[model samples]
Target: MYKKKYSNKFSVAPMLNYTDQYCRYFYRQLTKKTLLYTEMITSQELLYKNPDNYIRYTSNNQNPIAIQLAGNNINELTKCAMIAYSLGFNEINLNAGCPSKKAQLGGFGACLMLNPILLFNIIRAIYNTVPIPISIKIRLGTHNKNNYQHLYNFIKLVSKKNYCKRFIIHARIANLNGLNTKKNRCIPPLNYKYVYKIKKDFPNLKIILNGGIQNLQEAQKHLKIIDGVMLGRAIYKNPLMLCAVDQKIFSVHSIINKKILLDNMQKYIHYHSLKNIPIIYIFRHMLNIFYGKPQSKKLKQYFIHKIKNYTDITILFQKLSKKFNF
Candidate 1:
């Protein structure tokens, strides 16, 4: 499939520590047709290390998958973008919005906001080399809301070059001094109005709102105003929320059902285990699938620590399903 057809309008945000290969495979199974993204992989990590294990995506699924690359050096990031393109990713998202000390020290992530010129060049290089759609994911501002004008200017430059198809705005500021990344995700008040303003100003460019969106109702609200909405922590903790995505967002026939979803999860677990991924890596996220069901607390607690083998985890899941009459 080509570019426009891959943009599903609603997607699960790329969350670190949570959206790994196994997680994407499982999420793809549950959601059936939604776009899935790999967690942010630094260009340095991809080039200097073995990324095969990290960036694996099965061709059989043919799910619309995007790879997010974060780095500062223009040459390194461009090289990584080429690598991702060569690997057949439908889209490549540059991470300009992570609030972490390490990312700052690396001279990338939210810090890229400071050097929009360099970012422009990086985007230009990626666009020049890769035929896939290129996009930017960023926060509303780095330190002050007033910097939005600066962001708008960057978007103007990118759009003027016809290099960027979309801009995903995480409705929060990066507090470089006081807050950690998790706190940054929560402590900063989401100002969707700022995003709405961007949408109004740049009618030619697609503006995507991300962060703090929880359910389909909230997604519908944003979809009415912006081009798209991205779900992060909410989706990871409650992945079933995406089950209705095809019907709710894409206006497509829905193939997602509870039984089919579980079978899909089991299939991925088997595939991941064959690849030597630990059972806990797959089971840790599945525990949330049954979240809020009767006996969920007990089952979550049991699986959280009691899981020692794949067979035992499968048995416990079966027992929990029976206990909750699922």
Candidate 2:
């Protein structure tokens, strides 16, 4: 368990390819208080492959971060939770909301919503194995199970042991059979009212709402009804939105200096470059750092071109600073 309790009032969703360590590190530069999550890692991958490959990029600076794991087997989930706890993660999040076919085939993700007993057992096993907080990221329901009563009963069953107290409910129903992952995000109508009702009914459980929340103002509005809000694509597309998150959402007064931000990243990239890590791995996550700025497209192109030619990163930053008046 973390020495100090961390707030989940605001968070970035664990996107598969988007929420890698580089991205989480970049987001941390913008806001210190908002909780961060790693992209979902399956239990099988963690068990069979080198766990270090999955977690080596994590830094102590990324404190209060949670590792999202996907699997239905109680023993595997418990072992994964222990591994995450040993690695000093602040929380272990079960990925019950992912609608990807890969997740469906594994008998996890959104499908877990249909098997409340097994889901509850998995949670209980993990809770018993690790002392860190355990959270579940889930949709309201799945396919025909998409009803308030069904959702209510599922929540009622899972929350019985009190092992999992926090549930991050994506307000959309996941269509496991007919929809692709992309369609699952858009085709299903979001029923935020059902989420609000859950909060009203389960006053003791911490409820964080997810899905279609776009900005801080909207997050504040939802906070009026729930414990927190989780944003995914919105933050990935326009990261600058995080520039004001600490001050507006967490009530922590802080100033973001673009120069300082770039300088810190430059140093970080250079250090990694020494270890033979390609700059593209880190730079790709940064193309939007200058978002909303004048001539951002040209800047991104310049970056891509320089990286292709293997230009010195320090020189690239000097050029960027001069060209952009950073």
Candidate 3:
């Protein structure tokens, strides 16, 4: 119920195009406790573009949520953090862990892992500007240089500012030169041992593990060793994965059945539909609701062939819900 509790439990990764406001709201509907995150918003986009667009929401999710930022400029980051804080974000997470060419060329992401002082400056400025918690999402190391000490020292330098209280570590090294964003995520092997060592060394630090975690059982296994687990593609592909998260991990039996969940989505779709926003933008996030269940393939076919407008989608959903008894 408290904001601080969110900082300690399971969270969804701040993925671009995957964890936008609509997606966050949908996930929040399934589980109220797991901390949701915004997609990586660059400081430049907020500074040069309309600051309101990136952080805008129809209604805030009931659970605590955080906004992750990608940039190297101290002042811009501070301003962006302040803007996000005003929008009611519970935490501001710095991106020192992404390995995309865009992130590297833009002077943020895993590339910043090598430049601890600059990352420190950016995080410190944001920390001083906002009252909310500051966190850093990072990889173990970058470019095959997996020196365990370097990882330790990186955290030491960034946390020296005393504002960063939480750290989410992706248990893999980022390949800056040879890999693209997709490859960087999959090609690298996961070294959970190093992540465990981090918790062992910084016993006081809140270290959340990311990378290669899919099902609740795996998440529970990691939770035994670290403070939390951050799910990436798995939750996006099968969002209903979070339906059991509250009961299995947090030990609170969630009463969120399919009827209530889809009704909420219907309301959200109608709200956007009134604004003339393309319904597909929101419906695409809901396509996986029937994942791993009976009548799933049939429902997917209906979406592909039958969906067009809000009315069509809603009608089809109602029919499918009745057919599946969901």
Error of 1 at 191 (Å): 0.8
RMSD of each: 2.2, 1.6, 2.0
**Whose lDDT is higher: candidate 1's or candidate 3's?**
3
Whole-structure CA lDDT of model 3: 0.83
Q: Write the per-residue lDDT of candidate 2 for residues 216-246, one digit (tens) a residue.
A: 9999999998999999999987888898989
Cα error, candidate 1, residue 249 (Å):
1.3
Q: Top TM-score: which candidate number? A: 2
Task: Find the candidate with the highest lDDT and give its number.
Answer: 2
Quote the lDDT for 18 in model 1: 81
Error of 2 at 324 (Å): 5.2
Model 1, residue pairs in steric clash: none
Cand. 3 TM to true fold:
0.94
lDDT of 1 by residue, 182-257 (tens): 8999888888888999999988888889988888898998888899888888887777777678777888877655
Misplaced by over 4 Å in model 3 are 1-5, 51-53, 294-298, 309-314, 323-326
lDDT of each: 0.79, 0.88, 0.83
Clashing pairs in 3: none
